[model samples]
Target: MNIDFTLEKYKTLCETISNSSYTTFTFEQYFNQENPPKNCILLRHDVDRNISNAHKMAMIEQRLNLVSTYYCRTTERVFKPEYFQEIAAMGHEIGYHYETLDKAKGDVEEAIKIFGQELNAFREFINIKTVCMHGNPFSPWLNSNIWNKYDFRDFGIIGEPYLSLDYKDVIYLTDTGRTWADKNIRVKDVIKDKDHQKNNLLIGNISTTDDIINLIKEEQYPRICLLAHPDRWHGHLIDWTGELILQNLKNIGKAGIIWYRKNKN
Candidate 1:
Protein backbone atom coordinates (compact mmCIF):
# COMPACT_ATOMS: atom_id res chain seq x y z
CA MET A 1 0.00 0.00 0.00
CA ASN A 2 1.09 3.59 -0.56
CA ILE A 3 2.23 5.77 2.33
CA ASP A 4 -0.41 8.00 3.87
CA PHE A 5 0.15 11.49 5.33
CA THR A 6 2.54 12.43 2.56
CA LEU A 7 2.05 15.59 0.53
CA GLU A 8 1.21 13.36 -2.45
CA LYS A 9 -1.73 11.91 -0.55
CA TYR A 10 -2.71 15.41 0.51
CA LYS A 11 -2.68 16.51 -3.12
CA THR A 12 -4.99 13.63 -3.88
CA LEU A 13 -7.28 14.75 -1.09
CA CYS A 14 -7.28 18.31 -2.39
CA GLU A 15 -8.02 17.06 -5.88
CA THR A 16 -10.92 15.04 -4.57
CA ILE A 17 -12.31 18.05 -2.75
CA SER A 18 -11.96 20.18 -5.84
CA ASN A 19 -13.58 17.62 -8.12
CA SER A 20 -16.58 17.21 -5.89
CA SER A 21 -19.64 19.43 -5.93
CA TYR A 22 -18.84 20.62 -2.42
CA THR A 23 -18.06 24.32 -2.22
CA THR A 24 -15.12 25.06 0.05
CA PHE A 25 -15.26 27.94 2.53
CA THR A 26 -12.96 29.24 5.19
CA PHE A 27 -14.26 29.68 8.73
CA GLU A 28 -14.59 33.43 8.21
CA GLN A 29 -16.56 32.90 5.03
CA TYR A 30 -18.82 30.40 6.76
CA PHE A 31 -19.49 32.79 9.64
CA ASN A 32 -20.50 35.58 7.25
CA GLN A 33 -22.93 33.39 5.36
CA GLU A 34 -26.53 33.54 6.58
CA ASN A 35 -27.59 30.55 4.52
CA PRO A 36 -24.65 28.48 3.29
CA PRO A 37 -24.88 26.51 0.10
CA LYS A 38 -26.41 23.04 -0.02
CA ASN A 39 -22.99 21.38 0.23
CA CYS A 40 -20.10 23.10 2.02
CA ILE A 41 -16.75 21.98 3.37
CA LEU A 42 -14.95 24.30 5.75
CA LEU A 43 -11.24 23.56 5.28
CA ARG A 44 -9.13 24.33 8.33
CA HIS A 45 -5.48 23.66 9.18
CA ASP A 46 -3.84 23.64 12.58
CA VAL A 47 -0.25 24.74 12.06
CA ASP A 48 1.11 23.34 15.28
CA ARG A 49 4.64 22.98 13.92
CA ASN A 50 6.55 22.27 10.72
CA ILE A 51 5.24 25.43 9.16
CA SER A 52 7.29 24.89 6.04
CA ASN A 53 5.14 21.88 5.25
CA ALA A 54 2.14 24.12 5.64
CA HIS A 55 3.47 26.39 2.91
CA LYS A 56 3.65 23.41 0.61
CA MET A 57 0.10 22.38 1.44
CA ALA A 58 -1.05 25.96 1.02
CA MET A 59 0.43 26.07 -2.46
CA ILE A 60 -1.40 22.87 -3.36
CA GLU A 61 -4.69 24.40 -2.31
CA GLN A 62 -3.81 27.61 -4.14
CA ARG A 63 -3.20 25.74 -7.37
CA LEU A 64 -6.50 23.97 -6.90
CA ASN A 65 -8.18 27.34 -6.15
CA LEU A 66 -9.12 26.07 -2.70
CA VAL A 67 -9.18 28.55 0.16
CA SER A 68 -8.56 27.32 3.72
CA THR A 69 -8.11 28.70 7.20
CA TYR A 70 -4.74 28.06 8.92
CA TYR A 71 -4.68 28.42 12.71
CA CYS A 72 -1.09 29.09 13.84
CA ARG A 73 0.60 28.77 17.19
CA THR A 74 2.83 31.59 18.42
CA THR A 75 5.58 29.29 19.60
CA GLU A 76 9.10 30.20 18.50
CA ARG A 77 9.40 27.43 15.97
CA VAL A 78 6.00 27.98 14.40
CA PHE A 79 5.54 31.76 14.25
CA LYS A 80 7.31 33.16 11.21
CA PRO A 81 5.47 36.16 9.87
CA GLU A 82 7.02 36.14 6.42
CA TYR A 83 6.32 32.47 5.74
CA PHE A 84 2.77 32.77 7.03
CA GLN A 85 2.34 36.00 5.14
CA GLU A 86 3.08 34.13 1.97
CA ILE A 87 0.23 31.80 2.83
CA ALA A 88 -2.18 34.62 3.57
CA ALA A 89 -1.09 36.33 0.37
CA MET A 90 -2.52 33.34 -1.47
CA GLY A 91 -5.96 34.52 -0.26
CA HIS A 92 -5.99 31.99 2.60
CA GLU A 93 -7.07 33.01 6.06
CA ILE A 94 -4.59 33.05 8.98
CA GLY A 95 -6.03 32.45 12.44
CA TYR A 96 -4.47 32.16 15.86
CA HIS A 97 -4.21 28.70 17.38
CA TYR A 98 -4.02 29.85 21.02
CA GLU A 99 -3.20 27.85 24.18
CA THR A 100 -2.77 30.68 26.67
CA LEU A 101 -4.45 28.74 29.47
CA ASP A 102 -1.97 25.94 29.20
CA LYS A 103 0.87 28.41 28.77
CA ALA A 104 -0.15 30.46 31.79
CA LYS A 105 -0.80 27.28 33.78
CA GLY A 106 -4.51 28.06 34.28
CA ASP A 107 -4.28 31.70 35.35
CA VAL A 108 -7.11 33.37 33.47
CA GLU A 109 -5.71 36.86 33.78
CA GLU A 110 -2.24 35.85 32.68
CA ALA A 111 -3.70 33.80 29.85
CA ILE A 112 -5.69 36.72 28.53
CA LYS A 113 -2.67 38.97 28.76
CA ILE A 114 -0.61 36.53 26.79
CA PHE A 115 -3.46 36.19 24.34
CA GLY A 116 -3.55 39.94 23.76
CA GLN A 117 0.20 40.20 23.27
CA GLU A 118 0.32 37.40 20.75
CA LEU A 119 -2.77 38.53 18.90
CA ASN A 120 -1.36 41.99 18.46
CA ALA A 121 1.86 40.53 17.17
CA PHE A 122 -0.14 38.64 14.54
CA ARG A 123 -2.14 41.69 13.54
CA GLU A 124 1.02 43.70 12.99
CA PHE A 125 1.77 41.44 10.06
CA ILE A 126 -1.71 40.38 8.92
CA ASN A 127 -5.33 40.78 9.82
CA ILE A 128 -6.75 38.08 12.11
CA LYS A 129 -10.50 37.77 12.44
CA THR A 130 -10.79 34.23 13.83
CA VAL A 131 -9.06 32.20 16.53
CA CYS A 132 -8.96 28.52 17.47
CA MET A 133 -7.83 27.07 20.77
CA HIS A 134 -4.89 24.73 20.81
CA GLY A 135 -6.16 21.69 22.69
CA ASN A 136 -3.25 20.01 24.44
CA PRO A 137 -4.62 16.62 25.51
CA PHE A 138 -2.16 16.24 28.34
CA SER A 139 -2.91 19.64 29.86
CA PRO A 140 -5.62 19.73 32.50
CA TRP A 141 -6.59 23.28 31.53
CA LEU A 142 -8.91 23.90 28.61
CA ASN A 143 -7.71 26.80 26.46
CA SER A 144 -11.21 27.92 25.53
CA ASN A 145 -11.93 28.61 29.21
CA ILE A 146 -10.40 32.07 28.83
CA TRP A 147 -13.41 33.12 26.78
CA ASN A 148 -15.66 32.61 29.80
CA LYS A 149 -13.95 35.51 31.53
CA TYR A 150 -13.55 37.72 28.45
CA ASP A 151 -14.75 38.07 24.89
CA PHE A 152 -12.57 37.14 21.89
CA ARG A 153 -14.61 39.51 19.76
CA ASP A 154 -13.12 42.39 21.71
CA PHE A 155 -9.87 41.53 19.97
CA GLY A 156 -11.68 42.22 16.71
CA ILE A 157 -12.28 38.56 16.02
CA ILE A 158 -15.26 37.08 14.27
CA GLY A 159 -15.59 33.46 15.43
CA GLU A 160 -13.82 30.35 16.59
CA PRO A 161 -14.49 27.00 15.03
CA TYR A 162 -14.66 25.17 18.36
CA LEU A 163 -16.59 27.79 20.28
CA SER A 164 -18.61 29.43 17.51
CA LEU A 165 -19.42 26.54 15.21
CA ASP A 166 -22.50 24.42 15.78
CA TYR A 167 -21.36 20.85 15.45
CA LYS A 168 -24.91 19.62 15.17
CA ASP A 169 -25.05 21.27 11.74
CA VAL A 170 -21.47 20.61 10.68
CA ILE A 171 -19.75 17.26 11.10
CA TYR A 172 -16.19 17.66 12.42
CA LEU A 173 -13.25 15.55 11.26
CA THR A 174 -9.68 15.86 12.50
CA ASP A 175 -6.35 14.19 11.71
CA THR A 176 -5.33 13.78 15.30
CA GLY A 177 -3.26 10.76 16.46
CA ARG A 178 -2.28 10.31 12.82
CA THR A 179 -5.72 8.89 12.13
CA TRP A 180 -8.83 10.49 10.71
CA ALA A 181 -11.30 8.65 12.98
CA ASP A 182 -10.19 7.83 16.54
CA LYS A 183 -11.84 9.53 19.50
CA ASN A 184 -10.17 7.17 21.96
CA ILE A 185 -6.83 8.96 21.53
CA ARG A 186 -8.24 12.44 21.05
CA VAL A 187 -8.87 14.35 24.27
CA LYS A 188 -10.24 17.81 23.51
CA ASP A 189 -10.86 17.56 19.76
CA VAL A 190 -14.03 15.56 20.34
CA ILE A 191 -17.22 16.60 18.60
CA LYS A 192 -19.04 18.56 21.29
CA ASP A 193 -21.77 21.15 21.05
CA LYS A 194 -20.80 24.81 21.43
CA ASP A 195 -22.13 24.81 25.01
CA HIS A 196 -19.40 22.35 26.00
CA GLN A 197 -22.15 19.82 26.20
CA LYS A 198 -21.75 16.09 25.67
CA ASN A 199 -20.67 14.63 22.36
CA ASN A 200 -24.12 14.83 20.79
CA LEU A 201 -22.85 14.66 17.23
CA LEU A 202 -21.49 11.55 15.56
CA ILE A 203 -18.70 11.75 12.90
CA GLY A 204 -20.09 8.68 11.21
CA ASN A 205 -17.67 5.90 10.06
CA ILE A 206 -15.27 7.99 8.00
CA SER A 207 -11.58 7.40 8.79
CA THR A 208 -9.11 7.55 5.94
CA THR A 209 -8.70 10.07 3.12
CA ASP A 210 -10.41 7.61 0.81
CA ASP A 211 -13.31 7.44 3.25
CA ILE A 212 -13.67 11.22 3.09
CA ILE A 213 -13.43 11.20 -0.70
CA ASN A 214 -16.09 8.54 -0.98
CA LEU A 215 -18.37 10.36 1.43
CA ILE A 216 -18.05 13.57 -0.60
CA LYS A 217 -18.74 11.67 -3.79
CA GLU A 218 -21.83 10.06 -2.28
CA GLU A 219 -23.11 13.37 -0.90
CA GLN A 220 -23.71 11.71 2.45
CA TYR A 221 -22.95 14.82 4.45
CA PRO A 222 -24.28 18.27 3.65
CA ARG A 223 -21.73 20.09 5.76
CA ILE A 224 -18.28 19.22 7.13
CA CYS A 225 -15.43 20.93 9.01
CA LEU A 226 -12.14 19.16 8.36
CA LEU A 227 -9.40 20.04 10.83
CA ALA A 228 -6.04 18.86 9.51
CA HIS A 229 -2.66 19.58 11.05
CA PRO A 230 -0.01 20.60 8.53
CA ASP A 231 2.77 19.02 10.55
CA ARG A 232 1.04 15.65 10.26
CA TRP A 233 1.43 15.78 6.50
CA HIS A 234 4.99 15.82 5.11
CA GLY A 235 6.95 15.63 1.86
CA HIS A 236 10.33 14.30 2.99
CA LEU A 237 10.96 10.70 4.03
CA ILE A 238 13.09 11.64 7.06
CA ASP A 239 10.52 14.10 8.31
CA TRP A 240 7.62 11.83 7.46
CA THR A 241 9.05 8.74 9.17
CA GLY A 242 10.19 10.72 12.18
CA GLU A 243 6.76 12.28 12.60
CA LEU A 244 5.14 8.84 12.19
CA ILE A 245 7.26 7.25 14.91
CA LEU A 246 6.86 10.21 17.24
CA GLN A 247 3.10 10.41 16.66
CA ASN A 248 2.75 6.68 17.34
CA LEU A 249 4.37 7.18 20.72
CA LYS A 250 2.21 10.25 21.31
CA ASN A 251 -0.88 8.25 20.41
CA ILE A 252 0.08 5.62 22.97
CA GLY A 253 0.43 8.33 25.59
CA LYS A 254 -2.89 9.87 24.54
CA ALA A 255 -4.65 6.52 24.73
CA GLY A 256 -3.20 6.01 28.18
CA ILE A 257 -4.37 9.46 29.18
CA ILE A 258 -7.86 8.64 27.93
CA TRP A 259 -7.89 5.38 29.87
CA TYR A 260 -6.76 7.09 33.08
CA ARG A 261 -9.40 9.79 32.77
CA LYS A 262 -12.11 7.24 32.11
CA ASN A 263 -11.13 4.96 34.96
CA LYS A 264 -10.61 7.85 37.37
CA ASN A 265 -14.12 9.11 36.60
Candidate 2:
Protein backbone atom coordinates (compact mmCIF):
# COMPACT_ATOMS: atom_id res chain seq x y z
CA MET A 1 0.00 0.00 0.00
CA ASN A 2 1.24 3.45 -0.90
CA ILE A 3 1.56 5.51 2.25
CA ASP A 4 -0.40 8.74 2.28
CA PHE A 5 1.58 11.90 1.42
CA THR A 6 4.56 9.83 0.34
CA LEU A 7 6.02 10.22 -3.13
CA GLU A 8 4.51 6.81 -3.92
CA LYS A 9 1.06 8.05 -3.03
CA TYR A 10 1.74 11.28 -4.88
CA LYS A 11 2.44 9.23 -8.01
CA THR A 12 -0.81 7.37 -7.48
CA LEU A 13 -2.65 10.67 -7.24
CA CYS A 14 -1.19 11.69 -10.58
CA GLU A 15 -2.07 8.32 -12.12
CA THR A 16 -5.63 8.58 -10.83
CA ILE A 17 -6.07 11.93 -12.58
CA SER A 18 -4.39 10.61 -15.73
CA ASN A 19 -6.63 7.57 -15.77
CA SER A 20 -9.73 9.72 -15.26
CA SER A 21 -11.37 12.07 -17.73
CA TYR A 22 -9.59 15.03 -16.11
CA THR A 23 -6.80 16.82 -17.93
CA THR A 24 -4.15 18.57 -15.84
CA PHE A 25 -2.36 21.81 -16.68
CA THR A 26 0.34 23.96 -15.26
CA PHE A 27 -0.93 27.31 -13.96
CA GLU A 28 0.68 29.14 -16.86
CA GLN A 29 -0.69 26.73 -19.47
CA TYR A 30 -4.19 26.95 -18.07
CA PHE A 31 -4.10 30.77 -18.09
CA ASN A 32 -2.57 31.12 -21.55
CA GLN A 33 -4.89 28.61 -23.22
CA GLU A 34 -7.88 30.25 -24.89
CA ASN A 35 -9.85 26.99 -24.98
CA PRO A 36 -9.08 24.86 -21.93
CA PRO A 37 -9.90 21.18 -21.42
CA LYS A 38 -12.92 20.13 -19.38
CA ASN A 39 -12.65 18.48 -15.95
CA CYS A 40 -9.26 20.11 -15.54
CA ILE A 41 -7.12 19.86 -12.43
CA LEU A 42 -4.57 22.61 -12.11
CA LEU A 43 -1.53 20.96 -10.50
CA ARG A 44 0.05 23.60 -8.28
CA HIS A 45 3.06 22.56 -6.22
CA ASP A 46 4.33 25.00 -3.64
CA VAL A 47 8.08 24.51 -3.15
CA ASP A 48 8.07 25.94 0.34
CA ARG A 49 11.16 24.31 1.83
CA ASN A 50 12.40 21.49 -0.34
CA ILE A 51 13.68 21.54 -3.92
CA SER A 52 14.89 17.95 -4.18
CA ASN A 53 11.44 16.60 -3.45
CA ALA A 54 9.99 19.01 -5.98
CA HIS A 55 12.43 17.72 -8.54
CA LYS A 56 11.32 14.15 -7.87
CA MET A 57 7.69 15.13 -8.30
CA ALA A 58 8.58 16.93 -11.52
CA MET A 59 10.26 13.79 -12.85
CA ILE A 60 7.21 11.70 -11.96
CA GLU A 61 4.94 14.08 -13.85
CA GLN A 62 7.35 14.16 -16.77
CA ARG A 63 7.33 10.37 -16.96
CA LEU A 64 3.56 10.46 -16.84
CA ASN A 65 3.52 13.12 -19.60
CA LEU A 66 2.00 15.65 -17.23
CA VAL A 67 2.89 19.25 -16.50
CA SER A 68 2.31 21.37 -13.42
CA THR A 69 3.25 24.78 -12.06
CA TYR A 70 5.83 24.89 -9.27
CA TYR A 71 5.67 28.04 -7.17
CA CYS A 72 9.13 28.30 -5.58
CA ARG A 73 10.02 30.54 -2.69
CA THR A 74 13.15 32.72 -2.65
CA THR A 75 14.17 31.44 0.76
CA GLU A 76 17.73 30.33 1.52
CA ARG A 77 16.93 26.63 1.58
CA VAL A 78 14.58 26.51 -1.41
CA PHE A 79 16.07 29.00 -3.90
CA LYS A 80 18.35 27.46 -6.51
CA PRO A 81 18.63 28.79 -10.04
CA GLU A 82 19.94 25.50 -11.38
CA TYR A 83 17.07 23.57 -9.84
CA PHE A 84 14.57 26.02 -11.24
CA GLN A 85 16.11 25.77 -14.68
CA GLU A 86 16.05 21.97 -14.62
CA ILE A 87 12.43 21.84 -13.44
CA ALA A 88 11.39 24.29 -16.14
CA ALA A 89 13.35 22.25 -18.66
CA MET A 90 10.94 19.40 -17.97
CA GLY A 91 8.21 21.64 -19.47
CA HIS A 92 6.95 22.67 -16.02
CA GLU A 93 6.00 26.21 -15.15
CA ILE A 94 8.29 28.00 -12.70
CA GLY A 95 6.32 30.53 -10.66
CA TYR A 96 7.45 33.03 -8.05
CA HIS A 97 6.02 32.45 -4.60
CA TYR A 98 6.21 35.90 -3.01
CA GLU A 99 5.75 36.88 0.64
CA THR A 100 6.90 40.49 0.33
CA LEU A 101 4.33 42.07 2.66
CA ASP A 102 5.55 40.10 5.63
CA LYS A 103 9.16 40.40 4.53
CA ALA A 104 8.78 44.20 4.43
CA LYS A 105 6.98 44.26 7.77
CA GLY A 106 3.70 45.51 6.26
CA ASP A 107 5.16 48.51 4.40
CA VAL A 108 3.48 48.41 1.00
CA GLU A 109 6.11 50.57 -0.70
CA GLU A 110 8.95 48.56 0.74
CA ALA A 111 7.09 45.38 -0.08
CA ILE A 112 6.77 46.36 -3.73
CA LYS A 113 10.43 47.34 -3.86
CA ILE A 114 11.44 43.96 -2.43
CA PHE A 115 8.99 42.26 -4.71
CA GLY A 116 10.60 43.76 -7.83
CA GLN A 117 14.09 42.82 -6.70
CA GLU A 118 13.22 39.24 -5.74
CA LEU A 119 11.14 38.70 -8.86
CA ASN A 120 13.95 39.92 -11.07
CA ALA A 121 16.35 37.66 -9.22
CA PHE A 122 14.06 34.71 -9.95
CA ARG A 123 13.50 35.72 -13.58
CA GLU A 124 17.25 35.60 -14.11
CA PHE A 125 16.82 31.81 -13.96
CA ILE A 126 13.36 31.13 -15.44
CA ASN A 127 10.77 33.13 -17.29
CA ILE A 128 8.17 33.55 -14.60
CA LYS A 129 4.71 34.18 -16.07
CA THR A 130 2.66 33.43 -12.96
CA VAL A 131 3.08 34.00 -9.22
CA CYS A 132 1.54 32.69 -6.02
CA MET A 133 1.52 34.05 -2.48
CA HIS A 134 3.58 32.28 0.20
CA GLY A 135 1.22 32.68 3.12
CA ASN A 136 3.39 32.53 6.23
CA PRO A 137 1.17 31.43 9.06
CA PHE A 138 3.35 33.25 11.61
CA SER A 139 3.29 36.56 9.73
CA PRO A 140 0.58 39.09 10.55
CA TRP A 141 0.73 40.61 7.08
CA LEU A 142 -1.12 39.01 4.21
CA ASN A 143 1.36 38.69 1.33
CA SER A 144 -1.23 39.10 -1.45
CA ASN A 145 -2.08 42.56 -0.06
CA ILE A 146 0.91 43.94 -2.00
CA TRP A 147 -1.32 43.93 -5.10
CA ASN A 148 -3.66 46.54 -3.55
CA LYS A 149 -1.11 49.37 -4.01
CA TYR A 150 0.31 48.16 -7.32
CA ASP A 151 -0.72 46.05 -10.31
CA PHE A 152 1.09 42.80 -11.14
CA ARG A 153 0.32 43.07 -14.88
CA ASP A 154 2.56 46.12 -15.00
CA PHE A 155 5.48 43.87 -14.09
CA GLY A 156 4.60 41.43 -16.91
CA ILE A 157 2.98 38.99 -14.52
CA ILE A 158 -0.01 37.48 -16.31
CA GLY A 159 -1.62 36.15 -13.16
CA GLU A 160 -1.34 35.87 -9.40
CA PRO A 161 -3.48 32.81 -8.75
CA TYR A 162 -4.84 33.89 -5.36
CA LEU A 163 -6.22 37.25 -6.50
CA SER A 164 -6.49 36.57 -10.21
CA LEU A 165 -8.09 33.14 -10.58
CA ASP A 166 -11.87 33.14 -10.38
CA TYR A 167 -12.41 30.88 -7.40
CA LYS A 168 -16.09 30.68 -8.35
CA ASP A 169 -15.36 28.53 -11.36
CA VAL A 170 -12.43 26.62 -9.88
CA ILE A 171 -12.50 24.51 -6.75
CA TYR A 172 -9.42 25.35 -4.64
CA LEU A 173 -8.15 22.41 -2.63
CA THR A 174 -4.93 22.72 -0.63
CA ASP A 175 -3.06 20.30 1.61
CA THR A 176 -2.46 22.95 4.21
CA GLY A 177 -1.76 21.90 7.80
CA ARG A 178 -0.75 18.56 6.27
CA THR A 179 -4.39 17.75 5.48
CA TRP A 180 -6.97 18.81 2.92
CA ALA A 181 -10.14 19.33 4.96
CA ASP A 182 -9.16 21.19 8.12
CA LYS A 183 -10.36 24.79 7.98
CA ASN A 184 -9.39 25.53 11.58
CA ILE A 185 -5.72 24.62 11.08
CA ARG A 186 -5.29 26.58 7.85
CA VAL A 187 -4.79 30.31 8.45
CA LYS A 188 -3.62 32.33 5.44
CA ASP A 189 -3.79 29.74 2.65
CA VAL A 190 -7.42 30.52 1.90
CA ILE A 191 -9.51 32.35 -0.65
CA LYS A 192 -10.60 35.78 0.59
CA ASP A 193 -12.94 36.53 -2.31
CA LYS A 194 -16.30 36.31 -0.63
CA ASP A 195 -18.09 35.52 -3.87
CA HIS A 196 -16.58 32.04 -4.24
CA GLN A 197 -15.20 31.23 -0.81
CA LYS A 198 -18.56 29.91 0.31
CA ASN A 199 -18.99 27.63 -2.66
CA ASN A 200 -15.37 26.42 -2.53
CA LEU A 201 -15.84 25.25 1.04
CA LEU A 202 -18.59 22.97 -0.19
CA ILE A 203 -16.00 20.15 -0.36
CA GLY A 204 -16.89 19.70 3.28
CA ASN A 205 -14.33 18.43 5.76
CA ILE A 206 -12.00 16.60 3.37
CA SER A 207 -9.37 15.70 5.99
CA THR A 208 -7.03 13.35 4.18
CA THR A 209 -5.10 12.93 0.92
CA ASP A 210 -7.40 10.02 0.12
CA ASP A 211 -10.43 12.24 0.57
CA ILE A 212 -9.13 14.62 -2.09
CA ILE A 213 -8.34 11.72 -4.46
CA ASN A 214 -11.81 10.32 -3.84
CA LEU A 215 -13.37 13.71 -4.49
CA ILE A 216 -11.65 13.81 -7.86
CA LYS A 217 -12.90 10.31 -8.61
CA GLU A 218 -16.52 11.36 -7.87
CA GLU A 219 -16.43 13.93 -10.73
CA GLN A 220 -18.34 16.43 -8.60
CA TYR A 221 -16.07 19.37 -9.43
CA PRO A 222 -15.54 20.39 -13.03
CA ARG A 223 -12.41 22.36 -12.26
CA ILE A 224 -10.01 22.05 -9.31
CA CYS A 225 -6.83 23.85 -8.36
CA LEU A 226 -5.01 21.36 -6.17
CA LEU A 227 -2.27 23.03 -4.10
CA ALA A 228 0.27 20.62 -2.64
CA HIS A 229 3.61 21.24 -0.96
CA PRO A 230 6.41 19.08 -2.30
CA ASP A 231 8.23 19.07 1.02
CA ARG A 232 5.49 17.07 2.70
CA TRP A 233 5.93 14.09 0.39
CA HIS A 234 8.82 11.62 0.53
CA GLY A 235 9.76 8.43 -1.30
CA HIS A 236 11.75 6.79 1.45
CA LEU A 237 10.04 5.22 4.44
CA ILE A 238 12.35 6.98 6.90
CA ASP A 239 11.80 10.34 5.31
CA TRP A 240 8.07 9.84 5.11
CA THR A 241 7.89 8.92 8.79
CA GLY A 242 9.96 11.95 9.72
CA GLU A 243 7.70 14.26 7.74
CA LEU A 244 4.59 12.72 9.26
CA ILE A 245 5.86 13.38 12.78
CA LEU A 246 7.21 16.85 12.00
CA GLN A 247 4.04 17.91 10.18
CA ASN A 248 1.86 16.73 13.04
CA LEU A 249 3.69 19.17 15.30
CA LYS A 250 3.25 21.89 12.71
CA ASN A 251 -0.48 21.16 12.53
CA ILE A 252 -0.86 21.69 16.27
CA GLY A 253 0.95 25.01 16.15
CA LYS A 254 -1.01 26.16 13.11
CA ALA A 255 -4.30 25.24 14.71
CA GLY A 256 -3.38 27.30 17.74
CA ILE A 257 -2.52 30.27 15.54
CA ILE A 258 -5.84 29.96 13.73
CA TRP A 259 -7.66 29.95 17.05
CA TYR A 260 -5.71 32.99 18.25
CA ARG A 261 -6.27 34.91 15.03
CA LYS A 262 -10.00 34.35 15.28
CA ASN A 263 -10.23 35.42 18.93
CA LYS A 264 -7.95 38.42 18.34
CA ASN A 265 -10.18 39.62 15.54
Give the per-residue lDDT of model 1 (tens digit) for 68-157.
999999988889999879999998999999999999999999999999999999999988999999999889999999999899989889
Model 1 worst lDDT window (10 residues)? 194-203
Across 21-51, the per-residue lDDT of candidate 2 in tens digits comes to: 8888888888887765569999999999999
Which number leads on TM-score?
A: 1
Candidate 2, residue 77: Cα displacement in angstroms equals 1.8
Give the clash count for each candidate: 0, 1
In candidate 2, which residue ranges exceed 4 Å CA deviation? 35-37
The lDDT per prediction is 0.86, 0.86
Query: Could you tell me every candidate's TM-score relative to the true structure?
Result: 0.94, 0.94
